[model samples]
Target chain A: MTVTLIGGEMLHWSDRPATPALPPVGEITGRTLVAGPHPHDLIASLPAERTTVLLRGLPDAEAVAGLGVTVWAGSLDKVAATPAFDTIVALDGLDRLCSAEAETLDGWDERLAHLLTLLRPGGRLLLRVENLFGVHRLIALPEALGDSEWLVADDRDPHRPAGLAALRERLAVVREYAAYGDALLSREVLADAELSGFVSATIAGALATTGEVLADPAALATRALRHGLALELAPAWVVVTGGAADTPDAVVGAKAVAAADPPRGRTLEDELIAAAQRRDLPAMRALLTAWQKSPAAGVPAAQVIAGSASPAASDLTPLAPAGDPLVALSHFAAAAIRGDIAHLWPAPADEAELTALIAGMTGREVEPADVPPLPSRPAPGAVRELTAERDRLARELAEARAKHEFYEQQIRGRDAELKRVRQINAVLSATAPGKAVLGGLKAGRRAVRAVVKRGRA
Target chain B: MECGVHHANHYYGHSAVLARYCGLDDEAPRIQGYLQHGWNIGDGLAPDHEFVPGVPKFLWSERVRRRAWSLGRRDVYVVGAPWAYLLALEPAAPAEREGTIWYPFHGWEGQHVLGSHDNLIAEIKATEPGPVTVCLYWQEYRDKAVRATYEKAGFRVICHGYRGGWWKDLDPGFLYRQLAELRRHSRVASNRLCSAVFYGTLAGCAPAVYGDPMQLENEKSAFGGQARILREWSDMIGAEVDLETARRVAVAELGADRLLPPAELRRLFGWPAPRSTAAIELTGVLTS
Candidate 1:
C-alpha cells in the first residue's frame, strides 16, 4: 500500500479549471491514502481499497498504518517522524524548502552529507530544487511581487493612496521591464531599511505572502509536511521523495496532485506581511515603525496591542517603572474629581481648625526670601569664558585617555617582542663555537709560558 | 584584453596557442614542456625525472645546461616543471646564473600550479638573480606557491597568468579520427575501457597530445572505465616514448573545437563570444 501526502485547500481542488484527469485506481493497485486538511470528494473516486486519510493540525500516526511505504508530501522535514518506508515520493520538496527561506537554513551541508543515511543503500533520494544559479529566481521575482502586493492591498488597507501608487509602480516596472528591474526595488528597499535601523521592513514583503499563501488549507498542509520532511521550518511547497529502490512507478500517479499550477505571483506587501507573521519580532517591529513613518501611516495601536497580547511579544516589551509615580498621581486626581475624596483622604472634618491654619499662614505674612541666587543674568562675555573653560577641560581629558591607551599598547607589544628576541639570543649564545676555540688558545699559551719558566730555572 | 581563452584547462588545447603567441615554434630550442607531480615528505625530494630509472641525471641536466652554455650562454633555461628542485641542486654554475628556474608556486592540483607553503616560496626566492612570477589562475584554485614563499623570504614577487586568449584553434577531424582509432585499437585488443590505456595508445600512435594527467582521469572516468586507469596510463606513457609526442597527441584529442563545436562549446563554457568563424576556419582548412 502507498501513502500520498497532499497539501493545501481541497476546495480549490474541485474549483480549479485546469485540474488534470485522475488516473483510475486500477493503475494504482496499492492501498493509497491521501492525507491533508481539505481532502475533497474529488479524489474519492479512487477504489475503496485505497484509503484516504484527511488530517488537520498535527498528523495522525495511525494513518500511516497498513502502508508498505510512507511518502512525504513535501520536504524531508514534513513527514511526521516515522520508520523508513519501502518507497517515498517527493515531487518537488527540496526546491520549495530552499526557496521558502533563502535565509535561516544552516547545516544544509551536513544534511546533504547525511542524505544517503536516511535511505537504504539502494534506495534513491530524489530532489528537485529551483537552481539558485538558474534564471527561474530572476523571472519569478516579478510574479511573486505582483501576487503578494494584490493580497496585501486587498486584506490590509484599501485607503492608502501612496501604497496603491507604489504598488502600481512596482507592477508596471515588473510587467514592462525585465525581472532584474523588479528585483532592484526589493534590494533598494531592503538596503534603505537596513540603513535606517529597520531591517524587518525588508522581510515584511516576503512574510505577507507567506501568510496569505499558507491561509490556503492545501498549501499549508503541503508546506507543513514538506518542511517536516526536510527538518526545516515550513516554507512554500516543493516536492521531496526518498526510500524508493530506484524511481518508483507509484510516484508517477502521485506527481499529478503534487504538480499543481505554480503560485500566481504574490506582491511585495504580501511577502512583508508573511515575513512579519513568521515570528521575527525585531524585523516586524522595525517594519511597523517604518510603515508608521511612511506617508500612508496609521496609528497601528491595534497592532501594538495584538503584538503585546502574545506571550513572546510581551517578553519583548520594556519594563515598567517600579510603583509608577505618574500612575499613582493620575489615580489620586481622578478620585478627587469624582467627589470620592473620602476614599483617598477624609474631608476636612473640622472647618474651624482649617480656618485657624489658614489664619496662622496669613499672620506670618508670606514674603519672598532675599536669596542672592539669580545674579541678574550673566553677561555674554562671562558666559563665553565659562564655555571655553568647559571645552578646554573636555579636550584635555580626551587627549590624556587616548595617549594613555596608546602608550599601554606600545609597551605591551615591545614586551612581547623583547621576550622573543631574548629567547632567540640565548639559543644563539649556547650554540656559538667561539668559546671553545678561545679556551683552547688560552691553554696553549699557558703551556708555552710553563716551558719557558722551566728553561730559565 | 581578451582573457576568455585562458580560463580553459590546458588539456583543452590552450598551450599550443600560448606557444604560438609566445613565438616558441621553430625557434631556439624551447623548454621541451612542463610536467608536474606531487609527493609527500616520505617520497624522496628529487625522485627520478627520467622514465628509465638508471639514466644519468647529467643526461637530462645536459639538455638544459648545453642550451644555456650556447650563444655566449646568455639565454635562460626557464624551468617550470616539477623537477626544477633537482635542477637547482646541479653543479653547473653557468646554468644556475642564467637558468631562471620557475617552480609553479601553486599545488599541482586544480587550476593554480603554485603552492601556498611559505617555506617553499622562500626557498625559491632565496635563489638570487631569479625572478619569481606568481602564476594566479583566475576562476581556478588559489595559487600560493611562489608569492607565499618569496614574501616570507623578504623577496618581492610579480603576478602573472591573467591576460587570457591562450587557447588555440584545433581541428575536429583530427580529434574524431584519433578517438576512432583509440576505440578501434582498444576493441581489437579487448582492453578495459580506461582513458589511460586509450591515452597511452594515442601518445604512441596519434599526431599530438596535450593536457595533464587529471584531464586523462576526467575523460576516462566520465566515459566509463576502470578507476585505476590514471596510474596505469602515467606509467605506460612515461615509458618508451618522449614527452613531445605525448603532448601532441593530447592536443589533437582534447582541443576545444575538436571536442565541441564553437557555438556549443561557447554556450557550455560560458564564453563571452562565439568563435563561429574561427572554428569553421580551423575545421574547413586546417584538417583538410
Candidate 2:
C-alpha cells in the first residue's frame, strides 16, 4: 500500500531524531512518492525501501545520504505523478498553496483536481485547510477602550481563506466528506493585556487563535454564516478526508443532533455582566443555573457586572425554583437552619407538607431565606469599574511599595557608607601624618584660588 | 490513549482523561491517535517490555494497524480516542446537574490553554450559589507562577495539590486522578481540548473550550490518519466546540450504534476473550 504525504514542510520544524510522536514515514513499503516537508520523518520511517519525497527547494546532499528514500527536488505544485497510491495524506498542502498564491481561490481548484488525478479510484485524500471564520476572528480583534475590552462583535479584518463554501462547491464531485480542524483551545484575554491579533506574528497577546483554540471553528461559523450572520470565524487549518469513488456514509460522531439546549449560563464574564445590567431575567437565570456550583462564583460576577434593572430582578422570580418541591423543602430547611421561620416559601403553603419535604430533603429536617436577597444594583458604573480601578491601583501601589522598599534599602546603605567614609576621613585627619597631608592640600587649594584671583585682577 | 505534542504526554493524559467521566483503566486498550505520528511506528523501533503482548490490541487508526502489521504484529484494533468513546458511554445530563468547575489548561511556562485572564476563584466565589474548583495540569499543580497568574487576575487561588506543603507527593492514583476531582463540577471551560474538554463534556458538565493553546498542529494526528477513522472529532474544536456541537453530535450519534456497532467492536476488540491474570492486569476488561 502506498501512502503519499502532501504538504509544505511536514518536517520543517520536526525534531532531527524525531520524537516517537512523529513516527517514521518508512511504513509505506511499496513504491512511494512524498511531497513537501516530511523528508526527515519519511527517512526515519523507511527501511531500505523504494520511497521518494519531492522537494520544492534545493536538496542538502549531506542530509540525503544512502538512507533508502530518494529526495527529488521537484515541485509537487501540479501533483503530476501517476495514479497508483491507495492513501494520499495532503496535510494542509492546499492551505499552504493558497497562502503562497496569496489567498486567491484561483488555481486552487486545479491544484485540487491534480491531487484527485493522482489518487486511485478508491483512495482517500486526507486534506487539511484552515477555517475562514473562527472565534478568534471574534475575540482576537484589537481591543477598544484603552485596549481593555474584547471587540467581540466588531471585527473588520479581511480574512482570505479559500473558504469552505467554495471548497464544498468544488468537493461536491468527490466522494466521502469528513471535516474537522485543530483549534480546540479557547482564548480569553488576560484582564490586563489585549490579545495579539489572530494569525499575526507577535506572540505576546494573551489569547491567540493558533496558540489557544486548537479545534477548527469553521463548522460552527458556517452555521452562522449560512444564517447570514457576518463575523463567522474559522480555524487555522481544517483537515478533511474525501474518497474518490465510494459514497460517504455517516462516520461515528458525524451525525448532528437537535439544537443544543440553551447554555445553562453565560460563561463569558463580560456577557454575564451585560445581562445583569439589563436585568434580563432569562439570561440571568440561565447564567445562575450554570453558576450554581459556587455560591462565591455568582456574587463576584454580579458585583463586577452592573446595569439599571430594566425589568428588575423581582420580575424574574417566576423562573426561579419557587414551585420546586425540593426548592421549597430546601428553603424551609434553610430557614429552620437559620432559625428564621417568620418568612417561609414566599406565600402560604401547607405547613405539614413543608415539614415533610424538608425532612425528606435533609434526611432529618431542613435550609435559606424564602427569597434570595436581590444584589444591590450598583449605581450605573459603580461596583465593577470601581473594583477594577481599585485592583489596578492596588497592584500599582504594591509595585510602588516594593520599589519604595528597594530604594529605602539603597538609601540606608548609602547613608551608612557615607558615615563610614566620614569616620575614616576623620580618623585619617586625627593622625599627625594625615593631618599634615590634609593641611598641605588645603593650603595648596587656597594658594591656587589666591593665584587665580590675582591673575583675574 | 491519546498522544501529541500538546503537553508532556498528551496521549497519555487524554486517554487517561476518560477516567474523568467513566471509571476506566489506563491499559483499557486505546489507540493514541492523538499523537502526531500516530500511524507510523517503525519496524525497527524498540518493542516495549513493560507492555504485555495483547489479547485485545488497542490502536488509533487503520494506518497504525497496517504499520503494526508491517512490523509483524497483528492483534490490532482500530478505536479512536477517548472522547469519541463518549458517544458509546452512558449519557451525562448537565442540565440536571448543579455547580460549575473551571479547568485552566496549564502549559510549560505558566501558560493556560484558554488564555484565561479572569480571576476564576473570585468569579466562582462571587456566585453566591455557585462554587468553583480549579483544575490544573499535573505539573502546574506545583508551579506557583501559573497558579499565581490566575491569582493575579482576581482569584484567591488554590492548586489541586494539598492544602499546604503537606500533600505535595501524596496521591493514591496520581497518574490518572483528575477525573475523580473533575466529577464534582457540573460545568467546565478550559483553553485546550485536553483532559478537561474530553472528561468535562462526557461527565455531563457544560463545557467551554476557550484560550490560547500551544503546539496544536502537532497534535492533529490525534484526529486519526484515515478518512472517517474518528467521528465528530471535527465537531469538538473551535467555535463549534464552544457551541457544544460536539455534544449535540455525540447525543445524536449515541443510538446504540453512534460509534462503530457492538458487533464491530466485538469483532475488532474481542474484549471479552479469556485471558491469563497477568494479561488481564496489563490490559483492562471492557465492560458491557
Candidate 3:
C-alpha cells in the first residue's frame, strides 16, 4: 500500500516511538510519500524494500527523476497534468486561479470540484471542511471584538491606569469599529471570504475562502481584493495529486463521492426559528422530539429558538425530559436556549426535574401517545364538610367515653369501701353484749360484790 | 440539737429550691418539709418506697446498709460523662478525691465514635483519684468488656438498674432541673444523658435485662400501689397515695439542699440565714 500526504508536515512514521509497527504488506512492504512546506521523519520508518519520498517547497523536475513515485504540488489549472500521482488534495485552487487570483483566494467548493477531476476512478479523497453551522462563527465575532486595533492600542497605553473605565473605553471603541465594519461588508462577501480563507488554510496553509465572504457577494470584490493582496504579500504551500494505478480495492470502495454539493439547507436554527415564529406546536414538537433522539439535531435548533423572544421557548421546556440520546443533550439544549435571561429562564426546580426527567429519558424519546391525561379536580365543599363532621363526632365520642370511665371507676371504688365498712361493723356488733343482759348481770354482780366485800374486809 | 435541726431545715429549704429549679416541685416539698422535718402523719410513706401499708421507714434496713457499704463512700469515681451536679461540684471539690462516685451510668450513648471515648478516658485520668467506681444502670452486659476495660484502667465497676429502686423516688421535676443544669454546665453531660436515654434507648441500649421485669416485680410487690398505678388519677383522688407520691419523690430528690452545700445554697438559692462574720464585716466596711 502507498499513502500520499500533501501540503502538511512530512509523514515521518519512524519518528513516532509509540506508533505500533505496521504489518508487512505483500513481498515489497508498503511505501509512503509526503509533500509539504517542511519535511518530517515519518517517511523514514517505512520498510527498506518499500520506496519512500519526501517532497518539500515546490517539487522540481529533477526531484521527481527516475523514482516513478508520482509528484504532486498545489496548482489551479494543472490537476490534469498530475496523473502520475495516487491522490490529489486541492482546495479552491481552481476558483482562486480562475477569478484573476483575487487578493484573497475564493471558491473552496469549486476547488474541491476541480480536485475530484484529478482523482482516478475509484480513488480516495478525504476533504476536511469547516462546518457552516459551527459555533466558531457566532463566537468569532465576539472574539474579533477584542481584536480591534483601537482595543489593542488602548491595552498598550502605558499612561492609563488599569481600571474599568479604561477597559470600557476600549470595549466601546471595539464595538463601534465592529458595528461599522460589519455593516459595510455584505453577508455574502463576509461568508465567502471566511469560507475561502478557511479552505485555503486547511489545504495549502493559506486563507482561501470564508463563510462570511460566501454569504455576501456584493462585498466580495473588496474582501477578495484584500485577500488577494495578502496572498501576494505572503505565499503558502498547496498540493494536488492523482490516485496510483494500483490503488487497493478497499480504498476505492471507501472513497464514494457525495451525490451532490448543495448549499446547507435551512440550518437547524432557521427551521427552529420558523417553527417558533409560526407557533407550530407540531413542527416544534417534531423538531424537539427529533433532537431528543439525536442531540446533534437539537443543539442548533435550540440555539435558534432560544435566540428569539417567542413563547416557543416555554414549549421547549417539556422537551428536556425527552431522553432520546443520553439526557445530557436535552439539558444542554435547555441551557443553551434559556441562556442567562432570568425572565426567559425556566424555574430552577422545574429545570432540575427536567434534568432528572431527561436523565430518565435517556435511551428513548417520549412519544405523543405516552403522555397521560390531566387529573380531574375534587368537589369543593364536600371535603371540608366531611372533615368537619368527622372531627366533631370524634370529639363527642371521646368526651362520652371519658365520662363513662370516670363514673365506672367511682362506682368500683365506692363498692369496695362499702364492703370493707360492713365487715368492720359486723365485727364490732358481734363483740358487743345487749343492754338487758347487762342489767341481769348487774344484779348477780351486786350479790357477789357484797360477799366479796365482806371477805375482803 | 437546735442547731442541727436548723441546719437540716436550711438544707431542706435549699433542696426545695433546687428541686424547684430542677422542676421537681413534688419532690421539693417532700424532701424539704416531710423528709427533712421527719413529720410522719402516718400516711407519710417514704415518698414511693413505702415499707408496709402504713410503716414509712426503710423496707430492709440490712439491705440498705449492705448496698450503701458496697456502693457508697469508698471512693466511688464516676468517669463516664459529666452530670450537672458533678460539674457544679467539680470546681468546689478536689478533682481527685475519695468518695462514692455516682455517675448516672447512661452508657456510651454520648461518646463520639471518633475520639470521644479517648477524650473521656483522658478526663477521667486527669480528674479522678483513688479506685474509680462507675454505677452502670444500662442493661447491656455486652458492654461488660468496656466496663472491664475501665476496671483494668483502675476503675471499679458497679452495675445497677438504670431506672429503678430509688430512681422511682426521684421527682421528674428534679431530674429535669438537674439535667438542664448539667446540660448548661457541660456540653458533654447534655450529650451523654440525651443520647443515652433518648437515642440509645430507642436504638436498644444494651438489651435491658431488668427493665420490664423489674417494673412488673415492683407492681406485684406493691399491691395497693399497683392498684393506684392502674386507677385513673381522678379515681385515685380518694386513695391516700397517688400521683402525689411520685410528685413528692421528684421534689425531694431534686431539691437544692440535696444538690448543694450550705454556702453554695446561700449563694445559689438566695436563702435567708445568718450571714457569715466575714461577709457581714465586709458589707459593713463597704457601707462605711
Could you give candidate 3's per-residue lDDT for residues A1-457 as a string of tens digits?
2323334322221121111221111112233322221112223333333333433223331233234444443333333344432332211112212222122223444444554554555443322222222222221223354211221212233433233233234222111000111011112222343223221212121122232321222122223333542211112111112232222211111121121221222223334435544533234444544554443433323222221234223322221223333333343333322322111111121233333322222212232223232121111223332354456457546644654565566569769988999997667556645445666688899999999999999
Per-residue lDDT of model 1, residues B91-112, tens digit only: 1222111212122223223333
Q: Model 1's CAPRI class? A: incorrect
Q: Any runs in candidate 3 off by more than 4 Å, and if so which? A: A1-39, A42-74, A88-105, A131-457, B1-193, B197-204, B207-288
**Whole-model lDDT for model 1 versus the true structure?**
0.27
The candidate scoring highest on TM-score is: 2
TM-score of each: 0.17, 0.25, 0.19
Encode model 1's per-residue lDDT on A1-457: one tens digit a residue. Answer: 4445433211212111111333211122233433322223324444444333333222331233233333333323333433332322221222122112123222333223333334443332322222232222211222355421221222122222122223233222111100110111122222231111111211111222212111222222223222332112112212223222222111122232111221122221223234433423223334333333332222111111122223222212111122322222222122122211211111121222222211111121111121112212212223233354456457546644654565566569769988999997667556646456666788999999999999999
| Evaluation by TM-score, superior candidate among 1 and 2 | 2
Interface RMSD of candidate number 1: 47.2
TM-score of chain A of 2: 0.34
Candidate 1 TM-score over all chains jointly: 0.17
